[model samples]
Target: PGPLSPSPPQLRAQPQGAMQVGVQARELRQPMAMAMAAAAPGQMVMSAGMQQLAMLPCIDVQERAQWLQEATALLGAEIEMANKYRVLDQVGNQFFYAVEKTDCCRRQCQNGLCADCTSWEVDVLYTPPGGLMQKFLALRRPCSCVCCCINRPTADVIDEATGQKIGSFRDPCTCCSLRFQVRDASDTDVLVVNGGCCCTQPGILCPLPCGPCAQVRFDVEDAESRSTVARITKRVPSCLSWFFAPDVDSYHVTFEHIQNPQWKAIMLAFTIFMDFRYFNVNRNQEQARDVLAEL
Candidate 1:
């Protein structure tokens, strides 16, 4: 995996539903993490937690788009799989490679023994490159990114290296725009991410705070003061990429105002979670559409 170039995901037959995706998300593995940790020991940037938010140069460096581009989203159009992203710094320097992984055995286990696996829990891993090889930030979320108006998407952020629960993101279920509450480990709301205000109560001809547009953004604001402290942005590649491979997109995070490393890590985790929840073209949406067509 070159810094910005990740080989296509392993081609396998993905099942037809979200529950199956959930069955495969867990337990006893870090092979991919191990491999990359050994190979790119030098590429390892400073840790952001106990390591501190010392990598400002790498974090804020020119604010150039640091992409976590999806793995070959279009080598074959119909192949559906977990999301894989090539993380790069603002200058296009490869920093971390991210991918979501699952265990397929549970699909047939039918024995109800896979208690460790939650209904929609997804374990995303990154190593020195892949091998679960090592854990950076382990994120938990629903397998299906798409949710009806009743289902508000939420995600949890965990620091794997330290094995500490950092925080979580919860949606307010606003339909007209995008809004998520960024809460600390205590589940206390600390920051609010607004999708640029579209008014859910009235709700019409309004653009969602999170959309497919190239520069869609969600501003991270302080809960108490309600001041913009940081920002998360979504960027798309060429027109061809968006159409053929909807999952491939770039995300930029700004931390000039908020310097805490733990919160920063939480924000980063949410960015990945948000990408899958808002950007990826996974199985859930396709199945929903099929059901709708049949109806």
Candidate 2:
């Protein structure tokens, strides 16, 4: 028989770096129109202040071979996983990379920033399987202040090349268990984030524990049915990781077998956010001091 059909795209590898884009506020209205048409009777009703948002471009990764090649080139030996990634950037200081949870650069210092510093708006480069190097995603953390500290701090999800606003992850508030929204251009809610516990343990998760470590379940849901599409189990760093070294917070995100690339990307962004919320909360002060001095 002739050669069998090519394998599907392997989406196991995660992208690194980030890109910036120009986002127009008006583009968010399209998805709401589409969603409203499909919403159940009572579900489409919006409150007086509600708004509409756009949906992300449809991304299909079923092509296994192509996806695998891209994953290998970008992640390099790291296993490819959908919706699972570790926070490669540090906190308190600007500039960092969101490396794959499996593949990471161990070099002490590359470029001007060390491997352990917090990153701001880093570009994620990708070439697809047979494509050329292009900006994939950019991680950006906006500065926060005391007044807005308790507010659910959010990270802007920017499309590096076009500077378009693909989507944004609104983190859970520090004080409450309120729902968060993964919004698109029109700020329309694409995925609803609800039902999860936060990681409040101060130290590590080992022999000498500062506090009990619990995994926060970040459940991403559909805007209509409110059914779960993906879930991320996030836990605090270990004692050694928290105090001594810079480590990516431990977490696992799993998506439904058939998923949209846009949603997958949103889930990945959540992982990055969780990393900042958990590990960075217990940031290494000494490291922060040194990082600040370097700036």
Candidate 2: C-alpha lDDT: 0.41
- lDDT of candidate 2 at residue 224, scale 0 to 100: 53
Global lDDT of each candidate: 0.49, 0.41
After the best TM-score superposition of candidate 2, give how far the Cα of residue 25 lies from its true spot, in angstroms.
20
Candidate 2 lDDT, 1-295, residue by residue in tens:
2111111112222244331111211224323221223345434332111111012221211101223322332332322222223222112121112433222232112112332232334344443334354445666655443244454556676545345566676654545453567776556665666644333421332212233443445566655545555666555545554433333345555654313344445555655654544433223444545555587
Candidate 1 vs. truth: CA RMSD? 15.3
User: Whole-model lDDT, candidate 1?
Assistant: 0.49
| Best candidate according to TM-score | 1
Model 2: runs farther than 4 Å from truth?
1-119, 127-133, 144-152, 172-174, 198-214, 235-243, 283-295
